[model samples]
Every structure is written in C-alpha cells, then in structure tokens.
Target: MTYRMLALSIDGTLLRSNSRLSRQTKDAIEYVKEKGVYITLATERPFPAAKKIAKALKLDNVLITHDGGFIASDVDEPLLSRKLHEDKTFHIAEILENYKCHIRLLHEQFSIGNKVRQKNQLIARMTLGIQDPLYYPVTFVDSICEHLMENPVAPPKIQAQFFSAEEAQAASMELQKEVPSIDTIVRGERLEIVPKGISKARGVQVVANHLGISLEQVVAIGAGVNDIDMITQAGLGVAMGNSPEELKASADWITRSNDMHGVAYMVKEVFRKQLKVNI
Candidate 1:
C-alpha cells in the first residue's frame, strides 16, 4: 500500500517518556519525507506547544492543534479554526470550579489558566510545553471563572487537571451532562474539554483536503483515548505499547512504547525495504 501522508500524535506517540525527540525518530521522518510522504502533527495541544515539537522535527507543514479545533503552521495565518464562544467558556469554567481542578484555556498563541497552588494539584502536564514567554505567553489568574466574567476569551479548548482519576471522571460526566454539545476526553487525571464535533478526525480530514490526498493514503499513530477518532479513521492506525488496552484495541498495529522509540520502530518497519533501520 502506498501512503502519501503521515499524521502523528505528540506526547506519548512522537516524544519519549522524558518529553524529548530522539535522533532515530528524526532520521525516520527524514527518510519518509525523502520518500515523498507528507508529515504533520495532530495533537490536543495549542499551536505554540505543538509548534515547538514541529521545530525540533524541522517540519513546517500545517499542524492540527487544540484537538482539531485549530490548524495552522504560522501563528498569524490559520488555515482552519474552531473555538468555543465566550459564553460557553464561562459556563464550562463555572462547572469546573466545583471540582477544584486546575483549569486552563488554550488559545492559538496565548494561554489563560488559574493560579492553582495546592496539594495534589496537577501542574497542567509539566506546564504543557508552553515555555516561550515571548511567543506563547501564559497568564496565571486568580480565578478563571471570574476572569472570563470580566473578559471574554475565545479558545479552541480547555484543559483541567484533577488530583485523582475518579474526580476527573466525575467532572467529565457532570460537564457532559450540563453541556451536552461539548466533548470531554479523560487522560489519567486530566480532563480535556472541546466544543462538539471538534476532533482529530476533523483535523485529519481538513489536512488531507488541504494536501489534496485521500484518507486511505494517511497513517495515524496515537496513544491517547482522545486520539481514537483519527486512529479509527485512518487507513493504518497504530497504538503505542504503553497505551491503554482500549486504545490499543482500536489500532491496526501496536508498536513499541514511547520510551522505546515506538514511532521510529513502526516507521522503519513499514518502510524497511526503502529505508534503513539505523540512522
């Protein structure tokens, strides 16, 4: 089968356990690009966070970020964007405060989050890779709900980190019940909320159309439950070995864990005849 496009999920799929890219992975991507394959990142992160990884990979192609709610390579110009209106944002924030979860709103370039400093409070997944103060400035507010009440923010999505998975699950359920039009994705103790119909599947389809390719020519690799849609929609879907059994069950193949450089292993295996295993 000839694949024209390769879509990768960040975090556990593209990066290692320590949140770093490997030399082997870089070489594999270069090999595939030389093979005339297009590469892009499909992630739940905002553009700034995902763009940092793209810079490491040296890929300037359009990226699918914010769980498919936003897509663009350059910050100023966006090929596509889907964000929650301010009213919905405020309502979601109101619901989240009940659980005492650390909440953050994800914009295309900037970030607004609550100043959560307490025991067992999640630090928003190691700050969620937004370290560039000049490029991706993050604001830590005292109360996100109050901030929204005073000012409106149109964000692609919102993320909440809980102290326990049970709390996360409960929050997800309540949010879904209250806002039936929204979508909730639970990863361990983190709960990611996005507007309805916004998904990686939508992102992939948009990128495919932008690249003028068919879905059958795309290979999706992911490790998170939020990634299920794209993984299921692609011609070839792969799950990392460290992923949950349910996520693995959705994949057409299972590769090594993130620590073992699963993406490099899988890519090399697929194009072994054309690309060498060793860098």
Candidate 2:
C-alpha cells in the first residue's frame, strides 16, 4: 500500500507540550518529505499560526486552517473559504449572551469581543510570538462591544470560539436548538464554531483533489474531539495513545503518546508497517 497525501491535525496530534513542535516531530516530517510524500497540515489555527509549522518542515505547500473556514498555500493566497451567515452569527451571539458565555467573533483572527479574557490574552501572545499576518487587535474590550452594539451588522464569522469546554458544550447544545446550521468542535478546552458544512474533512477533500489523490490514500492523525471528523474521514486514522477514549475509538490505529514521540512512531509505521512503502 502507498499513501499519496498525509493530512495531519495540529495541536495534540503534532505539537508537543507548550504548543511547540518537537525536534522529533520535525525530523519525522522531514524524513517523510525526503521519502517524497506530499504532506499538508490541516489545522484549526489560522494561516499565520499554521504557516510556521509548515515552514519548519520546509514544505512549501497548501494547508487548511480556521477549521474548514479557510485554506491557503505556503504564500498568502486563498485557495478556498467559507463564512457563517451573518444572521446566524448575530443569533449565536444573542443566544450565548443569555448563557453568559465568554465569546469572541473571529474574522481571519481579527476578534471582536465584549471583554478580553485570559484565553484571548493567551491567544494574542501566541499570535504575536508567531508574527502571524492574519492576527490583529480590533479594539479594547469595552470599545469592541460598543462598536458591535452600535453597528447592528453581523460580522463575517471566520471563527467563533468559546473559552471553556463546559461553556462551549452548553452553548453548542443551545445553539443546536436555535440554529443547527453551524459546525462546532472542541480544540483542547476551547469550543470552536464555524459555518455549517465546513470541517477538517472538507478541507482534506480540497487538498486531496488538488493533489489528485483519492481519499483512500490519505492518513489523518489526531488526539482531541475536534479531530473526530478528520480521523473518521481519512483512509487510515491514527490516534495518539493519550487521546480521549472517544477519539481513540474513532481511529483505526493508536500509537505512543505525543510526549513519547507518537508522531515519529506513526511516521515509521506508515513507511515500514502499513504502506510498506519503504523510505
């Protein structure tokens, strides 16, 4: 067997502790590249945050980000994108407000919020550290709310993220009742909401089509609930040993935990075990 494309989820799947890529992960990716496989990263991170990782692998290729709301290449050109309906965006804000959910409206990383929570502050730090071009500070918390209230126009929601898992699940359930036309998932503890019919799997299809590779030739690996769609859709889904039970169940194979070089192990598995396409 042989795989023509590999679509990898970031966060728990690729990065190790501290949101940084390990030398081990880098070397594994580099080795795969050397073996002439087309590697494309699929991430919920915006292009700016995703680019650095792709660059580290010296992979000048296209990748997906913002769940399935955005796709771009090594350069800043858009390949595909989708936005939530404006009415739905406003409706979600209204519903979540009643639940006292701390929310942020993201349009390519330009976030508007009632207040800047610790999580937003952390994301800002990470964005700045990576020098992400899509990153921008819209306004102070109070000003942002004031502007939204006065404008009365729904912003294009590239991403709407909740700061907590419990709150997100609650909000997701509520939104499902009022408006089910949205794609929602959990990235780590954060709840991510995107336009309906958009997801990492859809993103994978786009990249696969571009490469002329069938879905059966793609392998996706992940560790969180957010990766469920990607894991199930890929031909051979591999879960990290540390992944949640539900996620592990969705995967066709499981490997060592991330801290134990799970990615390296899986890379070797593809070449030496599953595909037997010796590197």
Candidate 3:
C-alpha cells in the first residue's frame, strides 16, 4: 500500500528507555519526510510536552496530542479538540480521590494538579522525568475537585498516577461504571480520562480527513494500550518490541524494541520496501 502518513506514539515508541531520541531514529524520520511521507505524533501528553519533540523532529504535520483530544500543528489552530464537561471533570476527580493517586487536569496549554500525595510522589517524579518539556506549565491547587467546582472549566483530559498498575486498573473499572460518559484507559500505573468517543484513532482520522487521505493510506506505530485503536484502525499497524503482549497480538508487524532503534528499523525494513515498490 502507498502509505501517506506515519502516526507515532511518543513514550515507548519513539523515545528510548531513557526518554531521549536516538540519532538513528532522527535520521530515519528525516529520510521518510524527504520521501514525502507525513509524520505526526499521537500521544496522551498535552501539547506543550508533545510540541517539543515534534519541533525537534522538525515535523510540520498537525499533531495528535492529548490522546487525540487535541490536534494541531505549532502554527495552526486545533483542527479538533474534545474537552470534558465541567461536571464530569469534578465527578471524575471525586472518584479518583478515594485512591492513592496524583491527579492532573490537562488543558490545551496548561495543566492543574493538587498538592502531590506523599505515596504517589515517586510517580510524579517519574512522569516529570519523561515529560520534561522546558516550558510546560502546571498549577498546584489545594483541592483539585473543589478548585474545578469553583472554577468550572472544561478540560481536554484528566490523568491519575498510582503506585501500582493494579490500583490504576481498579480505579479505571470504577470510573467506567460510575462515569460512563467518559473514556478511561489504564496505561501502566496511569489512568487517562477523556470525553466519550475520543481516542487516538479518532484524532488520526481527523488529520487524515484534513489531508484528503483515507484511513487505508495511513500507518500507525505505538507501544501502549492507548494506541490500540489507531493501531487497528490504520492501514498498517506496528507494535514496538517492548510493547505489551496484548498490543503485539493486535499489531500487523512487530519491530525492534524502542531501545534497539525499532522505529528506524521498521522504516528501513517495512516502509522503505513499500516506497521502493511504489517507485
């Protein structure tokens, strides 16, 4: 198939385990762009965190950030953005407060969180290490739910980090039952909540439509459960070697793990082959 675009997940797909980009991956991306293949990042990260990587890669396409809740480039207005209702945001925060978790409410440009819990401070530190954008802004309130109740503004996404994946899953199940109007995805020790029917796949579809391409002409590569929809929805779906077994089961192909320069290998082995045939 003559693929026109590549949608990549940031955390475990493009970055190495240390959360840094490798020269091999950067060179591969440049090669693909030179060949006229569009590249964009599909991540659960907010725009400020994701934009830094996009700019480093020099990708000009509209980015699918906030787990597909926000789509835009550095220059253009968001093509699509799905924000949670004010009531739902507060209710979700209320439910999460029962657990030992660090909660964050994400907006297009800034995020708000309450005082970090002692137990979950490690999770917060880990997240800080990974999402280390120089200019990403965050505010700390005393009570996230109460603050949102008083302020009453819709947010693009709500995220919670737990000490264990089990706690994250338990909270996710409860959110699903109590808050059916939102979509909850448990990725490792973190749980991400967004408006119903919003996902990376949906975000990629919006970008495809804007580019006048069909789903069958797009390629998606990811290493997380949040990426499953786009992996299955894209014309070609690739899972990284470090991806969980479930994601690997759903992938059309499995490349090397992110640390091993899997993305570059996939581009040279899979995408390059197709491009060569087309030529």
Candidate 4:
C-alpha cells in the first residue's frame, strides 16, 4: 500500500507542544521517506516558518504556504499564487478598520503594513516561546484609511489575522451579515480573512497539480477549522485527536493529540498499517 504522497499540516498537527517535532515524530517521517514516500507540508504559516520545518524533516520538498496563496519550490520564489484582488484587499482592510479591530498585513517575508502597533504584551503573547516575533521586522499600518488610499501594493498578503478567534468569529459574522461575501474562519489563534472561496484546499490543489498527483493519492492532516478544506480533500484526511469535535467529524481518521506526539503516531500507523510500506 504505497502512497504517492503525504501532505501534512503544521501547527497542531506535526509540531509537538513546544512547537518542535519530537525525536519519534522526526524519525517516523524520515523512515517513511526512506521507504520512498513523497512527503510535503501544507501550512498557513509563511514560507519562512514552513521551510525551517521542511528542512528539519529533511523532506527536500516545497511547501504550500500562505494558506495556499503561493506555491514556491524554494520558498523564496513562488511558482504559483492566488492573490486577492487589490480592491478586495483594500475592502478587507477597511472592514477591519470599520469594526475597530486590529489587523496585520504580511508582505513578502514579513509584514508590510500594520493595522495596530505591536505592544510588548502583544509581541510577548505572539512569541509565547513558540516563535520569535522579531524573526521578521513588522511595519505598522497605523491608519487604515491611509493604506487604502495609498494602495501600497497589498502584494497578495499571505494572511490577515485577528488577535483572537472569538473576536474574529464575531467580527467576521458581523461583516458577512453586512457584506454577505466575506469569508472568515479561525486558523489557530487568529481569524483569517480572505476573498470568498480561497483556502488551503485550493492551495494544495495548486501543489498537487504541479506535482502531477491527484487528490486521491494525496493524504492531508490537520486540527483546525481552517484545515477543513484540505482534510476534506485528502485521500486520507487525518484530524488530530485534540481537535474540536467538528473538525474530527470531518476527518477520515483521528490521530493522537499533539501533546501526546500525535504526528509520530500517525506516521507509524500510515506506513505500518495502511500504506504497508515498510520503514
């Protein structure tokens, strides 16, 4: 039962509690790769963060990043991208401003414009020993109106994340009630605002097309609502055990919790049981 490919999601799926892969998980993934399985990742994380994990796994593969907004082999130069229409991007910013909510706009490697200042508290909370906010210098948008009028090249922002999920859900629901065209969903701690019908599932399809792999041969795993599309698309959609019930219900299988080394568990199960590709 050899798999043509395996596309894993990051965050709550692969990386363990400390935001790092455990030895077991690392070895299991490496083992499957040794068995000639094509391994890749689909993540909402920007290329910078995604690449590090890819290299760590020694997968020697490209990633689908920006929730599938861009696909780059080097993670430096994208091969394909689905950017939001400029006017739509502008409206997104305006919506956030009108709602009196804070937002951040990502450019190439880091943020291009900031909607709100990054106070120490915000920075500390974002980092949370999981990531270094200082890894990339972020610019503040300051005035929402100014950014829209200036139209300073939105450049296909990877994500527009709100500070909190509940707040994002609430705000997005309100916006959609008014606009009826807005697409908003939680990705980890933030709510992602994108033009309707854009998602990691669409992103992975871009990657799959480039690789000549059909959805039937590509397995995907994740733990968040944002991951629903990808999970629904994969040949084997695996949900993390700790994921919300809705997500689990949508998955083909549920792996262990992230803290319990779930990624490693599934890596072993897939190869040993399902794929039957000895490692």
Candidate 5:
C-alpha cells in the first residue's frame, strides 16, 4: 500500500546510541520528504526537547511528543493535548512517594520533580551519558507532592526512575492497580504514567485526522514498549534491530539498529518501492 506519513520515535529509533543523528539518516529523511512523504517525531519527551530534534531534521509537520499527550508544529498551536487531573496527578505523586524512585512531572514544555538525588543518581548518570540536545529541561523542588498540592495544575504525564527493573515493574503494577485512570509504561528502569488511552498510536491518529490521511497510509518506527500501539496500528510498523525482542516481535519489519542508520535502510530498502521512487 502507498504511504503518505511517517511517525518515528526519537530516543531508541531515530537517534543513535550516542543520542546523535547520523548524516545518512538525515539525508534519507530529506530524500523521503522530497518524495512527498511527511515525517514527524513521536516521543515521550516534552515539546522543548522534541522541537530541537525536529529543527535539526528540518521537519515541518506536527510532532507527537509527551508520549502522545501533546501534538503541535513549530509555528502552530497544539492541535491536541491531554492532561491529567490535578487530583490525579497529586495522588500519583503520593503513591510514587512510597517507592525508592525519583518522580518527574511532565508539563507541556518543561518538567519538575522532587530532589531525591540519592534515589535517582543512576538516572543522572544515564542522562549524562547521552550526548547533547536530547536532554529534557528539569527543575527539582524539595517536595513534588507538596509543590503540586500548593500549585495545582494538570500535567501531561509523570515519569519515575528506579535503580532496578524489578523495582520499576513492582511500582508499575501497584500504580496500575491503585490508579486505574492512569496508564503506566515501563522502559527498563524508567516508568511513565500518562492519562489512560494516551499513546503514540492515538497521537498518530490525531495527526492523521488533522492532515486528512488514513491510518492505512501511515508508517511508524519505534524501539520501545510505548511504541507498540503505533507500531501495530500503522500500516507499516518497523522496529530497530536494537529494539527489545517484544518490539521486534510486534513489528512488520526489522531493520538495522539505530546506530547503523536503520531508518535510512528502511526508507531506501522497504519504503522506496511503496513510494514508487527510483532514486
């Protein structure tokens, strides 16, 4: 089938292991765009962080960021945004406080969290390991629950970082049972909690509706569990070779890893035929 749009996940799919974009990948994206295919990023990052990547890629389409909670272009207002209720956000924080984790509340453009350096030092190390322009802007307060209680505003999502995958999974299971209204997604030791029904697939649907395209004409590439919905929902779902086994099992095709310019390989090898491009 013919494809008109491409939705990509930034962290593990587009960016290399060092969190930098390769020249071949950039050129391939530009080439696909020249062939009349629209491309945009769908990530768990907020707008400020995602915008930098979009700019570097020269993408002009609306981006699906905040794990599908916010969608907008550089020039336009957010076409769609889903925020958690203030009470729900506070309750989530309260529940998370029982675990040995660092919690960060995600706003539209920035993130705020409690100062638990000891608990989240590993996350800091992981963040420092990645290269420039991929980091999120974060503010640490003394008490995140108290801060939210005093200044109540609906945030799009909450992210928690744990030292071990077991801790993360346990916390996720408890949160899922206690807070059924929220959706929990675990990526290694990082757990993301967003409003129920919010996902990359839903975000893509919003983008598709805005652009007047069909779901069957969309292609999604990602490397994480958060991307599973969109991967299964899109007409062509691609998983990076570096992706988890679960993700690869769900994908229609598996390309090389992100560091090897998997996106470029997918576009040049798999998609070019569908687009009917000789170049």
Candidate 6:
C-alpha cells in the first residue's frame, strides 16, 4: 500500500523497557523519512514528555498526546484539543476521592496531581515539582478535587494510580458507569481517563486529514490496548512482539520486541520490500 505516514505509540512500542531509544530504531525512522514518510507519535503522555522523544527523533510533525485528547506540535498552538469538561472533572475527582489513589490532571502547559496519600513515595515527591523546558510542568496539592473546585480547569486527561489491580478495575468500572462522556484506559495499576472519541485511530485520521493523506496510506505501530484501534484502522497495523495477545491479534503483522529493535526491523524489512530494494 504506498504508505505515507507512520503513526507510532510511545511507551511500550517505541521505547525499550528501560526507556531508551535504540540506535537501530533511530536509523530506521530516518530511513523511512528519507523515503518521504511522515512520522507522528501517538502517545498517552502529555505533550512535553512526548515532545522530548519527538525532538530526539527530529520529527517535525504534530503528535497525538493524552491519547488523542490533544494534538499539536507546540503546546501553545494545537490542531485539536479535547478536554474533560470542568463540571465533569469536578465530579470525576469527587468520585476518585472515594478511593485510595494518586490523582493527576494533565493540561497542555502543565499537570496538577494530588499529594495527599503519596507523601511517602520518593518518586512521587520528586514528581511534584514544576518542571519547565526540561520536562512538563507538574505540581502537587493536598486535594485535586479541592484544587479543581477553586481553579476550575478543563484538562485533557485525568489519571489515577491505585494500590492494586482490583482497586483500579473497580474504580474504572465505577467511573465508566457514572461518567458516560469519558473513556478509561487501564495500564497495570494506573487508570487514564480521557473524553470520548479520543482514540489513537481518531488521531491518525486527524493527522492524515491535516496532511492531505488517507488512512490507507498510513502504517500504525503500537503495543498497548490504547493502540488497538489505531493499529486496526491503519492500512498496515504492526504489533510489537512484546505486545499483549489482544493487540497482537489486531495487528496485520507482528514485529520483534522493542528490545530486539522491532521498529528498526519492521521499517527496513517492509519499506524496503515496498521499494523493491535488494537490501
């Protein structure tokens, strides 16, 4: 299919387990870029965190962050931004307080999280600081609901880190039932909440439309549940070897594990074949 765009999920698909980008993967992306294929990061991370990797990869295209709730190259200028309504945020935070978890509200410019119960965790303490150009700004308050009650923000995403998988599942279920306008994504004990119609597939369509391309001319690669729709809807959907069975089943092809340079292998092998190159 003469693919023109390569949409990649960041966390488990592009980065190795240790969060490092391999040289082979860098080369692979450059190779495809030389062939005129546009690359975009389809991630659940905020723009600053995602933008760091995009800058490292030297991608000039826009990124789909907050699980497609926000799409933009710069935080100040966004092509698309879908945030949880202020009233809904208030209700969601109120519901979250009923459970034991670390809550975070992700905004394009900064993030606000709760520090009520996570005071003992060292990492959590360090994450409370407001970072700037170095990292996305994040701050902590005693109560997210209280902060929201006073500040009243419509954030792109809300996250909760529960102590157990069971608790996470239960909270997710409750949120789903109570809030009909939101979508909940579970990754281990972390629950990510975003507004509806904010899947990576929709982000792909947004990027495609902006670039004057079609979904059939895109190659979607990912390794998580959030990526399932993007992988299925693209012309060529690739799942990493390390991906869960559900994602693997949805993929048109499965590449090597991220640690084994899966992205490098897939791009060189497939794009080379498409170009009819002997290499």
Give each prediction's root-mean-square deviation over alpha carbons. Answer: 3.9, 4.6, 3.0, 3.9, 3.3, 3.5
Highest-lDDT candidate: 6
Give one clash count per candidate, in the order shown: 0, 0, 0, 2, 0, 0
Q: Of models 2 and 3, which has the larger TM-score? A: 3
Local accuracy of candidate 5 as per-residue lDDT tens digits, 1-279: 778888999998889988889999999898888778878899988777788888899987799988898888952388988889999888888988988777878787667776566633533423312322246566677777888877886888888888788999999998899886889988788888999989889999999888888888888999987788899999999999999999999999999999889999999986666644221
Segments in model 5 whose C-alpha atoms lie over 4 Å from true places: 74-76, 117-137, 273-279
lDDT of 6 by residue, 162-190 (tens): 87888889999999999988999877788
Tens digits of per-residue lDDT for model 4, 93-199:
66767553456555447655443444433331232124323456655656655765776455444244555666667766766675544466655455565556667
Give the whole-model CA lDDT for all candidates, comma-separated: 0.84, 0.70, 0.84, 0.69, 0.82, 0.85
What is the Cα-based TM-score of model 2? 0.80
Model 5 residue pairs with clashes:
none
- Over 32-98, each residue of candidate 1 has an lDDT whose tens digit, in order, gives 8787788999988789888988998889999999899999989888999888888889999999988
The TM-score between candidate 4 and the true structure equals: 0.81
- The positional error of residue 171 in candidate 2, measured at the CA in angstroms, is 2.3
TM-score of every candidate: 0.89, 0.80, 0.89, 0.81, 0.89, 0.92
Question: Candidate 3 lDDT (Cα, whole model)?
Answer: 0.84
Worst 10 residues of 2 by lDDT: 123-132
Candidate whose TM-score is highest: 6
Worst 10 residues of 4 by lDDT: 123-132
